[model samples]
Target: MTTATPQTATIGHLLRDTDLSRPAYEQLLADATLLKHQRASGTIVPRLLGLNIAVIFEKPSTRTRSAFEVALHDEGAGCTYMDSASSHLGSSESFEDTAKVLSRFYDGIAYRGFGQNSVNELANHASIPVWNALTNEWHPTQALADMLTMMETTTKPLQDVIVCFLGDGHDNVANSLMTSAAILGMDVRIAAPAPLQPDPAVVAAAQDIAAQSGARVTVTTDVDEAIARADFLYTDVWVSMGESEESWDHRVPLLTPYRVDAAMMSRTGNPKTQFLHCLPSIHDSTTALGKKIFNRYGLNGAEVSNEVFHSTASRVYDQAENRMHTIKAVMLSSLASMTQGDR
Candidate 1:
């Protein structure tokens, strides 16, 4: 929470939990807009020019990987993709050693992994820029994508928007969303069961930010109140990808009341109020996993009711595609700042 001025804006620690700052955040939005239009027109320019990046991920990803790969290539940056099957930290060498080595080889490093501490370990030792694709405590990059999509679709400055996230609110995405909303000055709300709401410390931090900005931060169990005036309604998978079946049963019941279905959308009162999900959404049984779960659990229709999710008011895919643009922005701005730092 140092104010992002000309001086403090130069660093890249976003929410402390996530690794991003206002400079990187703003740059990400700009980069996303440029890439979105260019990709729409079937054009690609490598603004990264000759830069090379090493993508180190422990967790498997669909959109996150595709976005980073596409954005880096589009920016004209070389990317070395590494999975756990390949070179891994603490296996072949120390995380410190890998960080030091990759720093000399690549201009920057992107990691999707277990703990915030794990990422901090890399960033602490690495001289080059360290990007957090996802961490146990925060997903800063995804927040950027979410914000960019909201901006593009709503055509409103982030400062004036009202976004409400439902279901399990203590997850990494929720934490990142709260931090980003606080930093950007947007109304942020979380509606979930008491045990499932966001961390008290995180909410307190966001409240301090809301005190400064005009953001109306709310945390409650009342679903109707949360979505009543929301311009955008957002949610992620009820369970994290690798979570166990026990966790699913435990969480599903707790979050049942907070699901975003037709009734939930109606609470917004504005038919144009958009709905967004981070993808791999259980909105339908379109995918193999979704089908199996739908049959096994006798889910009847969908977690979200396909009618609502597939409706014209749903902007889920728009949010999905902006993942690339916002990430591109983070890379370009962070690297460019580093380059400018040399002068």
Candidate 2:
């Protein structure tokens, strides 16, 4: 068996999936797995001792913020949380200024916000390593966690696995998934409406990665064809952050056809097909948004059904938990690279 051995020395900033090579990506997963085991066995060695990290967010978060804080803490690094109201990044002060200021106090900076250019600007201006938590273009951390979850669950090698994503393929989650899957040599397919298809540049980039890795990257309008033999069915909210509430009238109708219900799961033709979602999911008419969606569309769910979301095959929470482990791995590897004069 070929084990992962990432060239940590070469990795500088993790702004996107293209930042690391195939070996590095696999090695990161291997690192995350080892860290997870160490954590479970209560033998986790903190490599980042005495280091301070900043978690800056222009948007609200439940998993990313918690995961970063807990993961950094577990690794013996101090964490500082800066929410939208507290951190005047690009509002009262420029993002470049904030980046320079934060770089002074924090050894590393994690940013989750609206624009890709914003994060890019901070990375360009800051001397320290900058991690892209999320932007309209990509959610690299979530993709890492999702890959970890799939790595743990899949019976075969990573290259043999197939993951099909349904819903608005234009979103960050789908874009990240495509790039990561391509890098890891997993067969990935995205099914969505023509207008909601992934960015052409992202697709082209993933295609380039796929060529070397032997990963098949497919984007299509045919939902059945996309999930035909998929080992995992993945999706995210039809409407995402930075999108207007009024977009529901347009997106809901366009995307409802791609909803992952029991019929859709059955169509995969893989009985063991696992369900994956980057929550908070609209599986039932419980939450206010769920209730509103139900009232407006008369649908129980938007992207995924309650039956699949609550079923034994649902690995969404597992995906959620892996965020901390993989995130810790990212911080450790990035910081280690910096300390060893690799960057």
Candidate 3:
């Protein structure tokens, strides 16, 4: 049997088919946009007051860590950052015990663990909101940031857009995209080879939701047809974190045809076609890993060419910054309701 909290959980779980209505999701985007504007204009920010949150990161991250920590801090909430290396929860004790203890200490918990099952196990035991900072199966927070970025750039409802996701199209990011595409009414296309396509179950679920939203979902190896109607081009790293360097030899050849360079953009045929990524992109050698790969594997760019990733069309930075705003919405809304119920 699948582990789950009681029916009346605090925040709706962000799993593939969890019941987060589009109106609710859009409201979060709107709230985040407004908060961003307010913060930009120099105003006193909203505070979470009594809420306490904890972040447990198994994989090190620069953007995700900074965005979440700063988001809670800016909202006047107490945040305790945890280390997987030294933490008692998993390192010393069991996951179930750690989750139960954390549920009592914090209003919300965000964790990035080795496997998807670990995060799900925590949610099953913890009564409070459990956010997936990242997982092997999904990165829901990044999905929120992506949709928000698309809205910020296009000024169009997600339902009206054709968002094309190309390149290594079946990783954690791709899964999150498919999940959110179901939640919203966006036309979704994932172009990847047979071995790299999205999970069949996710595709079936998205097809079901698309039928309801009047959205179209298509999976194909034919890059030409996939990008024909595209407004936004999205991609992620060819190899995800925690993956060994040896995997590059296997991934590069499999993913090279899917790279987003000027030619692929040209194939889109949409002059206004925007680009989005979840950052830490291997489009350049800015990072040590990228440089090391360049030196050892003779690869300057992996899944996306630096020319496109750094071009005027790349919306990655905007996408990166939106993580803070959207995450705040998820935290505040859930915490507010908890406070009301307590009173």
Candidate 4:
């Protein structure tokens, strides 16, 4: 892990995982690890002390929002949050206008929303650095946190680790994970039904990256093949935000077979194999969605079983906490010119 310096800052916007070069990606991971220790030791030196950032969420969030807000505050910066209902981003004002306006007031913008183009359009217009919090196409920040978590939890170097992601292979998290893994030279696998598999373009792009980085990328319908010998097994909700509840009517039957349970964990054939999820998971009949899933499907969990999610092998929480650290590193790296103290 290399230390991140101001000179390492290159990209002005992180709209996708490929936005980061391998060195830049590793640098952020190293900085994130350093920041985590700094926070724990109460030795954090505020870098972006006078910076103000605007965080806008067209989609609902808990972890992503909290991570950005806390990361800003922890670094002695100010942030203004605008939720879906509160923001005039897409209604009264155009994205270009909104971006131009925010650039005048804020040092950067963080957007979590429906379209990849929306965030890209915003970044195209804004002079300040922009981050894609999450979009329909890619969740770059989540991938960064995921990678950092893998690095921390495993003894093997990331390039040597095998990661298998199951369920909704075409989704944002899957796309980002595949791309990130390719960039980092990791063995990445995705398992899903034929119709639910990743987009061909995304797969091709990942393969191109893999060719350059020495990564092995595999996409298949066989869950057993994907999970075997994997160091980490990851999944996300079958249905994503902004999608209608009617999605469950079709998705349930298609994704049930891919559900991660004790049996799937055992199939990994490695006692040291760990579980990962970018939750809001239906591990129990607690939340409204979980209850609906349990009642209709007669299954306790939709994507991951409760036993595995609560098991010692689950590193989801560690992955969740890394969101803040990695996001902080992103902001620090991108907006290094604005920081006042030592990075």
Candidate 5:
């Protein structure tokens, strides 16, 4: 495993998948793995004691929120969480003002919200490191967790792994996944309808990175071409957060063919092939969105079938749990230079 040298001074923030060099990414994963072990064995050490962080979310989250709060607490750091309803982040107070105010009270700020520009503006004004938990353009933290999960689940080297992401190629998850995979020299394929495919600029950028890293990047409408011989079959929600319910009407018809069912998994022709999803997956008609999808589309699930989601091949839970460990590593790495005296 490639270990990362502590480069706290250089790692000011995690705003995008490409923010860190490949070695930096590997180090975070290495640290995350060690942290996981330490936590499981009850040998945990607090690294960010006396530090404080502010997490602001314009959008709701489950894994990202829980992960950050728990990771900070485990490291003996204080965390204050505020959603749009609670804080006048963008409504009353400007991002610049909020950033300045939070910088005085916290060692770092993590924002999960709608726009990339919003986070960028906050980072511009804030003296402390600013992490982008998620934005309209990228979900860097989720991508990091996904990378860690892939590293843990596979026997192959990071560069040798083949990941095929199905459905909603234009979304933030796909963008981050493609960028991260390219950084690690992984073979990444995106299968989606023409309209839903990743932005041409993102694809071109990933291709450019892939060329330098010896990675094979493929964007195709052909599911067979993307999934064939893939080690991991990945997917996300058909409809993302903050999307109108009307999105289902159009997305259902377009994404239905790309859903990760047993049939799609078998297409990989590798029994060891695994399934990955950044939940809250609609694998069953349990949630309101799931019920709505079922009632309207006459389908039990969207993006992924229940059978595949529950199968042993499903590593979603491991992926979900990894969010915490990876997040801990990121927080520690970025704040590595900080000391109790500084705090």
Candidate 6:
């Protein structure tokens, strides 16, 4: 991994996974792993010593929000968090104006929101690095954490690994997984009902990346076919945030068959196959949504089962933990070289 010098201080924002080349992706992973170990050993380095960053989230999050806040604090930086209710991004003032104003106060920005265009507009306005924490289109930061978890759990090289995503294949998590896996040279499979499969353009884009990286990218409706000997079984919420609750009426029946239950895991034909969910999962009737799902559909889970989510094969929690490490790497690589005078 080549280190960035002061001359190359302003690394571009991570608006999407394709923003990173193969070498850059690998470098970030290596940096993340080192940072994780350093954090564990109490030798964590603080790169953003005097920097101040802001996280503006238009969507609600548990992992991403906590990860960004903790990661910045660990790196000796000050951070301010603005939730959707607190920040009037488009309603009160334009996203462009908000971006320009915030850029002056913060060194970098992390935004999780509904439209890709919002993040794009913000990035266009700000001179500093802007990361897309989430959008309707992509979740690159989550994908980074997920891949780091995969590397920790598997012995095979990335090129030889197979990962299958089940349910809501069109969602942000699926898109990012396809994009990141292709860049990392992993065999990627998407299994969902026909209506919920990933966008053709997204598949085509991942395929183009795969062609250069020797990765295989496939989308299938047959759950058994997609999961065959898969090294990882991944999922996201069948319906995402900002989507109407009414969407569940249609999505539930269509996605139930693809749910990551023990049976679906067994279909993988790999007993060692680990389960991954970009959670807030409907694993049990613990949350209000989970309870409603069970009561309405007579289904205990939406995209994953309780048995699997809490099982030994689940690495979802580890995946969540890695988000901090990888995000720290992104910020450090992007802003660490800039000094007070440079700013």
Q: What is the number of residue pairs that collide in model 3?
A: 0
In angstroms, how far off is 211's CA in candidate 5? 1.4
lDDT of each: 0.78, 0.88, 0.79, 0.92, 0.90, 0.89
How does each model score on TM-score? 0.90, 0.96, 0.92, 0.97, 0.96, 0.96
lDDT of 4 by residue, 159-188 (tens): 999999999999999999999999999999
Candidate 6 lDDT tens digits, 235-292: 9998888889999999988988888899888878898999998888888888998899
Residues 9-29 of candidate 1: C-alpha lDDT, one tens digit per residue: 344533243344455456557
Return the top candidate by lDDT.
Answer: 4
lDDT of 6: 0.89
What ranges in model 3 sit over 4 Å off?
A: 1-10, 13-19, 339-343
Those runs of model 1 whose alpha carbons end farther than 4 Å from true positions after fitting are 1-24, 41-45, 286-288, 300-303, 337-343
Q: Which stretches of candidate 4 lie over 4 Å from their true place?
A: 1-9, 340-343
lDDT of 2 by residue, 15-113 (tens): 877787887888789888988888888887666777899889998899999899999888788989998888777779998898888888988999999
- Name the lDDT value of residue 262 in candidate 2: 89
Q: Model 6 residue 229 lDDT?
A: 98
Please list all clashing residue pairs in model 1, or write none if there are none: 14-20, 32-325, 46-75, 46-76
User: Where does candidate 2 clash, by residue pair?
Assistant: none
Name the TM-score of candidate 5: 0.96
**Which 10 consecutive positions of candidate 2 have the poorest summed lDDT?**
1-10
- Supply the global lDDT for candidate 4: 0.92
> Predictions ranked by lDDT, top down?
4, 5, 6, 2, 3, 1
lDDT of 5 by residue, 23-57 (tens): 88887888888889888977887888789999998
